[model samples]
Target: MDTAYCTADGTPYYIANFAQLSESEIASKRRQLICVECRWPAYFKRAATSGQGACFGARPHAPTCSLGAPPSKKGPGSNEVQDILRNPMNHIRIDINYGAHDKVNGDPSDVDKANTRGGRFTGDGPRGPSPMNRRLRPLLKALIESEQFRNSNIIVELPRYTSLPANQLFVNFDAVDEGLANEFRGYWGLIFDTGMSADGSFWLNTGKYDDLSILITPEKYDDFKRKFNFQLDRELEGMHLLVLGKLRKAWSGKLIIDVDDVDRCALCDD
Candidate 1:
């Protein structure tokens, strides 16, 4: 349940056990994560996008849509936080199947995915889908649902993020490293899964969300020590690894492709 994210300036943002939290805390962090996602340059505008690479700016990289105002971690949260308020238990039970199915955003429930909504496993190799753009969903949804989209004339994708604190990254990474008996450093928004496929498809496909780019900055990574003491909790560390191991086992080994390459998606051709 470790989650990873990058800021608009390309700084890494993460929280190790980001996914494994009480509905309240996870929902809170998710709000911050959403800001990071939409804070980028909109893809269509060259001014904003000329220097900006991530598709989060909401205006196609136009200076008009520059990530001009950096998000204050202390600012208001994203509405996706509403999920918890809408149905806390459903939010808890909405298994995202990180790395295996969709990268994050808890792959869409059965009713949403179509062949175009490719749901392959990342473990299956390059043929599978890529990791989820954990940040985009709520942020994009909010902007589009608001006057933001109405105010512009550009096509865009959602941003992804995990919205974890600095200390939590180490705690969760260490958890999954041991849990899955592998070296998974981080993930975006992910939830626990229910079961795995028999033939090793090992993944689920929820097309409700599209993928996003990762944002990493030197400051974001270097500030780790200032965030949390990694050595403080052994019990929580054990829990982290346990969660990862289970997540790996449930993956369908299909593909975790990004939404950017939909035309090439196997599901699309199928």
Candidate 2:
């Protein structure tokens, strides 16, 4: 396992197999690297002598760390580094709910009249539950329990064009209200759309009601497509996305986010 803990922050850092630092480089940052589970100091060992290839471990005389134990041959092996990264908060979860009653100018007059009261549907009809209604509780839990959620800024995108109850869903979390939005880039939503432009730039839309757009630079666009093997046209069509990016409200009162990091965007799984 090419994993170590940062004594400075008590956070675990993974050194990928391809990017292992040289001994001297590792030594320079030694003060910041330690065991992932415990704060024990750790060091990188190159493969030649240890036969373990590249691995990280505490000094031989250091106190025992449970994760240092040898693997069991009978069961599936766990990759701790991958496990940490797989935590739900590390990825934004998107859920798009487009309902039937949301249709416009399609239903017959008789049917529409029957469902309408005061020019609006009397009951929930087809708009479905509000995004905040369904998502806020779980998100609050993630905020409390997930270390990655605390360390990294994230965006949780929700559905747009829905009539949320009392407009509660659009309100920012307490953290966001207290200047954390600048640090965490708190959740906001839109009916997301994406496509590749002819000029090789990537285009994104945040909502259906307006012409708001996001532009992914050609260089970053190509890099993400290559790194993730992502097909923007195929993946984003009619699919709602949860975007994590540097969000800014344009002078035109429209939102624009620049997604330079591949990890900043995720297709909503639910």
Candidate 3:
């Protein structure tokens, strides 16, 4: 769409063309882009070398967004997935430290509390703020403020395991260790394939490396399929996906996450 709402002032603006936006303008506007319909987070895409025109689209359209587009009539070209996979950033790394907030043996000094307020963990041990949090802070801030994700549980740092079970939130796994599968079951990776089940559920695959896949529950399949414009079976391949849900070990020993809510998932641009 040519028009988009800005998060800065909650005002609509007409983007005549991407070419008209300078680098600084693009960077500034892109961060605040929002969908005019549901006021959810949206992204601005510049015109491609292939002559495709510029447009604004939702990162993940709200469930009730009236302006959300239906699945495209034409499927993505073969090279589309390859192009996204070529970018290393599209393959996101996930860290799920269950005990990130454990109190250190040393007492918290007044300086520590003053420096880090609002219940921010002051522990400086190995369980303290992770490298992933430092890297993803800016993006997480943007996502948390975005209309679509603001209400969802935005978990950057791991919450207390006592309050929320690790299985109920997220878990990370190493390829070599299958023993901890039950404890740490969450899967994160670059999606490379997707298919529809005979019963109409949507399944996403991250290829054979980690043997990870996501099963979008049948009730949520339509909304997710439309939101991401996944008409064809493989439409969502190459997108970055982070999903939290029930983990099931398939007969083939692949890890499949059964997702019942759209809010527990985040799909990022390539």
Candidate 4:
């Protein structure tokens, strides 16, 4: 998971920081981080040959994921190459080298991105609590002070760092001790599935994240909608198809929303 853009430990601590503002304002400012970190690798060669696109413009699931099977409307895996071909809901490669502008406009790294280019949004009140993460911090502080994690809800905490504990937000939530940590709130962010290419080469297709972006070309989006009986709301038809790619650690049949559409965007507000 290590990458030049991520922390030394390879976690995306920064992306979690975006929701503190209105989702739309994030793009005007925050995505600048992704554009610089992910899209523009210092070494030109690495940018072209080695990097996975910072912003995905397609689905997030690859065939190799545990729930490679379709969750939206399921039957059985199509044995035929054509059926698989007809519905590209299967594994698709994400082009690591993409125009910086395109990814930002798609789902955008943060919620507050839509109809914007650069700058930040501020001057607001009652924007809700700082975020769920802020609430988690004090809850963890109390657990450490009580010094009885055996009965405390603080789970997944790192071993004491010298005398300090790792922040509760970054503690590995997957490792939560269910028996003792049922009441402590935890954020169940979507789990994205990425994997190797059809040629058996590893690739970080962020599209496997189903929630990323559809990246459907203006031409293709229109063509698909006109040809099919399904009605893809005109606004969203252009966005990528979203569905949780995997089920192991993510929710089942979770709703998928177009990251850019004003309405679909609300599903993420949770």
Candidate 5:
């Protein structure tokens, strides 16, 4: 694929013009890339060492998508819509079993977020064995690939938080605003840019709408990187990130989501 639609600038992007962009420009636009035809998530593939030129690609497009390659002579076409129907997402839930370190009030930095206003909680320590918690990838993938799922009234319930319709619960970064402040929502978007603060906390930011970002504290850095295979040096500008957290405005006026546990977040490629 050579062309894609950028939701950041609301324009079509051609790979041939990719080189015209500076490093910073690419970093900003790459995050908002999507398929021009079906609007599925899209990504930029940099020119490889093997001699391939830079190009655009996306998750499997619907069979009817004009950008998708033709079906092979040996088999029928791929139908994302049909596949979603065969195995629909019943509901969204992420349950993380806490360890001794995660006990409430165990560490000085650990604060009980409940019964308070504008207070943040960092998980005490390492998470215990993951129980049979439903993964968010399938649901996130469905939301990205299926318009029906995105607009559906499916339920998304996070433990300790109020359940809401999928349409209302999952908000893209582009739609974030002050009205949504201090509420727990499934905030998701592309990785426009990333940076490490002097405090050693890392930020995966969407460079629009008050610079919405997901914060990974220093305590959780090791676990977060190990869980997500994250590398700051890598070209991660266009990857997808979904975080289940309370949307809060920082003292600096930046919209932020503090990820207390690694399990509360998920990342994927287009």
Candidate 6:
């Protein structure tokens, strides 16, 4: 776990030279790292104040990966997360009412009572489908890591829109067009580059066709950066972004999603 690949910059990141990056840069790199050998996902763990060196860890590396980092020990609720992810008939509700400062409410203990239709959790206790309010980050990670999840029939509940199948609710940036305008969805895509408009609005420019972008209004700029621990000066060209917002066509004939709150967005290094 001394080295990993940074998909954002397409380079091998060494742990020893970790000090060279600014705090913001380090935070950004932490989310985008992957195993150098097997290409499995990896994360950065900051050095403890007790003098332990900073290191990298992965959920589970490929079986053939030489690093030998064992798969993370799963708890009683761990398999349940994946179970609901793969089962099409399962329902997962997303509660976006929390603020950026609030903890991600992904705990299975907070299961939604409304999700009792198909009896996905009838017999099993702790191992059953713990249908609860999901956070965007984990759901976005699932979509990126599993093609089956992207096409799954899992029902996701969001504000105003109620519930819809995962495949219908999440749309890629390249697939987005004016046809989806006024429709609310979880718009996900890569960040080709970023820009700050003259009016102080921040734009996460998607390099996809038709000049698609995610706009962070001047009002939400500071919160957005603080929530994501983002630095506009950092090289964010290849980062993946997911925003829960309504698609709209700009006055300039460009497709865009204007994110109203920091809690409505998620960004990853992959």
Please report the candidate that would top lDDT against the real structure: 6
Segments in model 2 whose C-alpha atoms lie over 4 Å from true places: 1-192, 232-234, 251-253
Model 2 scores worst on lDDT over the 10 consecutive residues at 166-175
For model 3, residues 1-270, the per-residue Cα lDDT tens digits are: 678887765667776654376776654556566788888666565555446566677644676776764424233321232222232222222222211233334335553343233222223434433222212222332232233323334333322211232223334222313443454333443454466778987777553343666788787776666554555554354345665545667799887777754544566553
Ranked candidates (TM-score, high to low): 5, 6, 3, 2, 1, 4
Cα RMSD for predicted model 3: 18.4
| Candidate 2 vs. true structure, TM-score | 0.31
> After superposing candidate 1, which stretches have Cα over 4 Å from the reference?
1-49, 52-77, 85-171, 182-186, 189-270
How much is the lDDT of residue 218 in candidate 5? 94
Q: How far is 162's C-alpha from truth in model 4 (Å)? A: 66
Local accuracy of candidate 1 as per-residue lDDT tens digits, 102-193: 33234455522432243322233343232222222232232322333223322222223232322232122112322432322222222111
Superposed model 5: Cα runs more than 4 Å off: 4-13, 28-53, 57-65, 68-92, 95-133, 207-210
lDDT of 5 by residue, 1-270 (tens): 889888988889889897479988787677677888898767676765447677787654665888875544221112333333343344444433322124343433322222121111223533333221334655566565656766777666665676787789888777888789988888876665577889998888774432788888999887777776655524555567788888888889888888976767777764
Identify the leading candidate in terms of TM-score: 5
Q: Any runs in candidate 4 off by more than 4 Å, and if so which? A: 1-18, 22-25, 28-58, 67-238, 241-270
Error of 3 at 11 (Å): 51
Candidate 6 per-residue C-alpha lDDT over 31-136 given as tens digits, one digit per residue, 9 for 90 to 100? 5678898886665655555476667655445667778533363644445447556543377766554333744553333332333232344334455554555667
Global lDDT of model 1:
0.25
How many backbone collisions does model 1 have?
55
Worst 10-residue lDDT window for candidate 5 reads: 112-121
Structure candidate 6, residue pairs in collision: 32-269
Candidate 6 ranges with C-alpha deviation above 4 Å: 1-89, 97-99, 102-130
Instruction: Give the clash count for model 4.
Output: 14
Worst 10 residues of 6 by lDDT: 110-119
| Tens-digit lDDT track of model 4 for 175-241 | 3332322222222222222222355322111222232222223433433334322342322211222
- Put down candidate 2 lDDT per residue, 88-122, tens digits, no spaces: 33333332211222323344454333322212222
